[model samples]
Target chain A: MLREVVVLGVGMHRFGKFPETSLRELAGEAGRRALKDAGVLPRQIQAAYFANALAGLLTGQESIRGQVALREVGVAGVPIVNVENACAGGATAFHQAVLAVGSGSCDVALAVGAEKMFVGDTGRTIQALAASADVELTHDMGLQFTAIYAMRIQKRLASGALTLRHLAEVTVKSHRHGCLNPYAQHQKEVTAEEVLASRPIAGPITLLMCSSVSDGAAAAVVCSAEAARGAPQPLVRVLASELRSGAFRSGAGEELSTAARTVRAAYEQAGVGPEEIDLVECHDATAPGELLYYEDLGFCKPGEAGRLLDEGATTIGGRIPFNPSGGLTSRGHPVGATGLAQIAEAVWQLRGQAGPRQVQGARVALTQNSGGWLEGDSAAGAAHLFAV
Target chain B: MTQGVFRSSTDGEGAPSLAGSRCRYCARVSFPARPICPWCGREDTEPVAVGRRGTIQASAVVYHAPIGFTAPYIVALVELAEGPVVFCPITGCLPDENAVPPGTPVELVVAPARAGGAPVFQFRPLGG
Candidate 1:
């Protein structure tokens, strides 16, 4: 019989700029914490997956990044697979770990995502971001991601489906929630006017509306159901984990965003409707992104996202708590580590371990993350569902 | 970045046009040329000159630019007359209308890139 996998532990090293720390150090700290939380020693892990983006470019640590980082936590001589799936790197690593345990290849597995960003020149950092797009096609054209998102926003605006006030409200809500998350990069709450008044990164996209270039790490420990017998912690099952690449041509046509396709597969796999999800942590790389995802993820109907926001349906104490960990807008976007951070938050909410941001009686949750760009769509996307 | 992707020479009493690839089997169009047909996964594709005129599907101005690029420049997604969409900077616009709204019509032009950079393919408002 096939075995089930459960996340036995989750850990994070906060989300903020840390020029003093190295990637290995950041990863090591998160790994050790996860091991402690799971009550498992280094020797118990049969295999591991390490997720990191730009380690080679920014930190000069290419190849064997897992071996270098894991060795710091006294883990060695195991099959350590390195994963880089753009912004979905961390969750992809966790997905592989779940597969490892579910396939009975290993009883216990580890997944860690770490990065050290914002320590170099601003222009170089910006260039690294452009690498997410097509280098030969879009990057050389000098396209900025904020500009890319702005194009979508402009289209929506032209259709009268959304407004600038709705965009500002998204950031305002994120900041208010981020203030309660200890690991968030931007913890201070800001008014909607402040978000609009911030320096513009692109048309209609202010600096505050964009996710910060943060440095941090997040780790997870997973084990087979048999191996987790009598484990001294609340068992949270991995109900579903789905990964899909952006379509050059989707059945629904290329006009639909990639996240729309990825989320549908996840929901079908989990057999859970959007209404059943008690909480959610989605890839809000920009504030406008979150509003659009509400429709794409089926949280609302098309062109009704602004109405949902106005109704306070997405706030922490509302009909559904979205991004209780502040999301990328406020929690910080450490690219490689962002996905696992969402996973960690999901696990915490399920285990009732979340302190201030805890959703009352939360039973089911989802995390939708995507990154990279090509041909005007996300290059990769992934979504996972968790339940207690 | 390569200098330009469009041909400078004329084609049979026709105006100069952009170089793109079209799948012979599936009739799918790709900008800047693709070796394989992305739709049918076939290698049989032909080089074709795409029309120079396109409509602006969307537009935005970047205040934060990459290394060696100027800020607050316009970039628009233009749907070519041949049904291929390309991203190009829109030129010859009034300084105030940096972010062109969707549905504006534009035509192709080759110009020196920002700050004396490489020559890049650009789009200007139709009849502007």
Candidate 2:
């Protein structure tokens, strides 16, 4: 029998570009905050997993990233492992920590994700992101990331299932919620008109609609539920962790079903369904990506995301609040740190500590993050379901 | 220093056909030829030629192109009638509903890739 893992504490270094701040400082801030919140001393951490992507190419700090970052918080001599799985890096590390704690390999495990992107120039930054795709296939395409969603959005538009206004609305709502989140990279709210007026990066996705190339870190402290019993902090249960990578590409369809596969696995593990979810913090790398996820994850019926949005189901006061943390669009997508930041947001919401963006009485939360792109689907998809 | 995606050759009827790979064990087609079958992982793959005709399964308009590439270029993921989906740029195409809609018929053709020019496989609208 697997022991139930509990998140003792979670912390986030606000997602943004801090040119002056080093990656170590960003990771240390979040790690220290998590340890402090969990009432855990640095010496108590038995193992650490650091999650990051593009640091080697951009920062020249490749292996032992966890040791370099966690050492700043006085964690030493513990086994520090590093993992990189594109945008899912953070959640991947967190899942490893959960497994470590549940398997009795370690009583206390720390998962920290830090990424420093947008390095000196746009060309270099884009080149780093292109590593997520099969560079051999897509490198010459001269477009990274956003184009895939743009094509899907174009299809939706052609089908009359969506319009540019709908796309802009998604960005507007994300920014509106981001304003309530102090940790969000883009905190100021903007109108749909402003979103439409913003610079276009891909078809129907304006610059504001894209997740910022962010630099930040987030950390989580995990242990068995029994171990967290007396901790002086709110305990969030790690109900389920599910991960799925893109299957071998065939001409089956344009949309990759990794999210669907992972969510099903997660629901099975958690003994819950999408209908039971109270709120969500998903990877909205772009507006269309979120809309597609709503359909793929079965939050709503297939081809019904537009209607669901029309019903205001994903807004703060809606029946199922989505991306209450502003998602990647506004909260920022720091590649390595994004997944843990999502978990942090969920923990805060479950603890009733989310000041303005709280989803009332949120008891269960789901997080969906996908990374990299191959063929027409995400190469890696990781979904997490958390409960109080 | 650019090369064609496939070493094109004349078919039985003297029409140029795109070179690809056929799974000797499963018969699944791979564009530009892969030694191993992605669908079945069979290593008995043989090089074959594919006709240029395909349908536009998906498409995207990139407003912000990478370095040395111009913006506002249209690229599509095309599903060949034979097998496999090929993601390639569409010449003079747009992602508008009035243009380059999914399911639109396309024919692969050799075209200049960048400004200075290198031979590359591009697709063009068959009709309308």
Candidate 3:
């Protein structure tokens, strides 16, 4: 049997433009905060797993990023493994650290994700990120992720599965919550009229519907449940942590299966279901991504996401609060740090620490993150269930 | 008879795409570009240029574009003269209407893109 693992502490650097902080420094700051929150010193960390994407291509620093980042905080001689799973890099690192602790390979482990991407020119940076898709198909077609996902939206809408208003509602709702989130990159509340008036980036998705690129870092401390007594008050438990790779039928059109499988695995591990989830933080790189995740995670049936949005089933005070921290749509997607931030958000909700956006009496929370494209679908996915 | 094929590069001697086959065992058409007969998936597959003219299978207008991308572009999936189908963007056409309608005729042209700071191949419309 696997040892039980619990998240002792979590910390996230503010999720916005931070041109003055280097990636290493950003990671160091988050790491230090996580250690402090866990009441553990830097030297007490047995090992560190770092998650970063685009550092090699965008930042000119590739090799040993984990070593450089961790050493900056005066923590050294521990195994520092660098993880690069595109946007899911952070969650993947967290999963690894969970494994390290659950498998009894380490007592105290650090899972930190950091990225510095806001310094570059817009066109170049976007082009580089688009390269993460199916190059052979996307390169010549000029189809970036936004365009590809937009195609899915078009197909769904054309099939009478969704409407433009449904898309607008999600944006409006996210913005409403985002306005209450001080750390959100976008805090202004917008109406559906304003969202509809935004510049279109793809068939149905507008520029305002996409996530902003930002620099940030997030860190988590994982240890056996026995190590949790000394942690801060109101402890939150890591009920389950799971990762699922690309499904064999990914490009065959039913790509949601990957995320579904990951969530299912997490549910099985946590001994719970979507009905028990009071809060969730999902990968909302685009407005539609969040909508689709609702169905994929079993919160609703396929194509019913639009209805869910209109009903406000995902709002902060709704049946299940989703993305209470504003999500990537407004919180900024710092790639590597995004996954960890999702976990942090879940922990905050579970511990009743999410101030204005808190889901009252939230006890069970879920996080779903997918990254990279394989065979025209999500290449990597991770899901976790947390409780208090 | 005159023959044609698609090259990986704009220049000759790049990579040749072949069509049809006359296997020593039995004559048949093998779609994959082969040095030897593809009937056996062996060294006998031959190299040939199947030419450019093709039938459009499907088409869509990309109303939303990626950053650094031209908006309102026409993209299509086409069955080549050789029979192999390819997906490409139909450039130089009206955002509203284009000969790129499904089952319409189309040809290939070279285009530019960014790859590791270098320009790469992108497909464009063939004719007006």
Candidate 4:
């Protein structure tokens, strides 16, 4: 009943502190690159979804963000929709684009995510990031996202499910991958001693183990299968795309974590399981997050994520590689831009175009991007499966 | 303190009691008191006081603070005896020391959120 959707092209601007770059410029560059890669003009795009989380709070560009940014890249005269879902905005936009094409509404759609966090004021950016949580209850609580992750890690550490060594090791791996990624913000590899000795942000999390505030943009072009008949690039099918919101979880209940629930739905939609995944681009905002998601994404059972890391299973050459683009910790988390950046990485690897970080023989790739925090879970969780 | 989050003690000498609502239809309880139950979308709910004593489920000493907050403060998620978790600052504990470990019993108290700021509810290690 529904048409098949495929990703035609993807593009990204490097992630780092680009104080001289404007939001429009950042978005326009990525959008233009995606169009060029797809061999399509801006006018060919029937609908556009622009994702930016902090522009309203950080840059004061409240409404019509999509229209304003896309117009600079000759993306006018199209129905542009703005999306904001904290860190998962880009994936949300992509999900909408896929739906648009699959529902027979449009043949070509575009999703773009961009953020400029180096606004010459660090305090304001931190303040805006904190607004992603329940402001009513946590405004006065001095809530930092690092602290939330630190708390979770502390509990696991106490239970002996993880160790300080595991945290440092995963960070080392992230940086090692980042060193091969030209777009990564922190490409220099770090030693375990250096990671442990670095400045502590919260609990056991060090400065090197966390993602930095970055400025960047990423974009993707989606089209119906018929539109991709003779495309220059290899066909990349959208096997599944799912987006879910956090439900009320009391922590004591048996309710699965939001990521688990979302990924399960994606697996069902795709008619596949974790064993079929060749590589993954998980939302590892912090070092330990990658280990936790090994279990959350069903790659391993509980209490065995550290073992998966210990076995070097998540490295580029290992089974089920993760964060081949250095992930958020090193790729730089420009918030809204992170999701699309992951998509771009997946597309590259699937097309055998990834220069140094490609997972050999990679075919099926999954991306799990989460955003915000609500009721002790990510407010928005998205899992999209792509195959070549 | 945010309005409708807590109420003054009857004797007016102790910390204000945290408020919540219990649904009559589904019997689900929500903190900060909701007019309607979040579980079943039922408007039949009653305001009730949640327990002030709880155990620290997790705690972290934040070195980087956001605006209006000082660095090196302890923030924690405590599971109240009444079966709800609340996120608040842990008072009466040095940031550098692991004085209040997870599972440590704590009692709610009112303290200034920041220098010269209005008093808000926080937790302190029992008998510390």
User: Best by TM-score, which number?
Assistant: 4
Q: Docking category for candidate 4? A: medium
Compute the DockQ of candidate 1.
Answer: 0.54
**Model 1, B34-128: lDDT tens per residue?**
89987799999999888588888778887777787777688878888877777777788852444356667788776554776666678888889
Query: What is candidate 1's TM-score for chain A?
Result: 0.97
Q: Model 3's DockQ?
A: 0.22
Reference contacts reproduced by model 1:
0.57
Error of 4 at A169 (Å): 0.7
Per-residue lDDT of model 4, residues A18-108, tens digit only: 9899999999999999988888888999999999999999899989999999986689887899999999999999999999999999999
lDDT string for model 1 (A1-388, tens) is 1677899998999999888898898899989988988999999999999999888877778799999999977789999999988888988898889889988999999999988887767577767877777676664577788888888887678789999999999899999889999989999998888999999888889998999988999999999888898887799998888888887742223466788788888889888989999999999999888988999899999999899999998998888888999999999998999999999999999999989889889999999989898767788898899999
> Deviation in angstroms for A52 in model 1?
1.4
**Structural similarity to truth (TM-score) of each candidate:** 0.95, 0.93, 0.84, 0.97
Predicted complexes: DockQ each: 0.54, 0.51, 0.22, 0.64
Considering summed lDDT, which 10 consecutive residues are worst modelled in model 3 chain B? B114-123
Residue pairs in collision within model 2: none
RMSD of each: 2.3, 2.7, 5.5, 1.6
Interface C-alpha root-mean-square deviation, candidates in order: 2.7, 2.6, 7.4, 1.7
Ranking by lDDT: 4, 1, 2, 3
Off by over 4 Å in 3: A134-141, A250-256, B1-69, B74-88, B96-128
Docking quality class, candidate 2: medium
Error of 4 at A112 (Å): 0.2
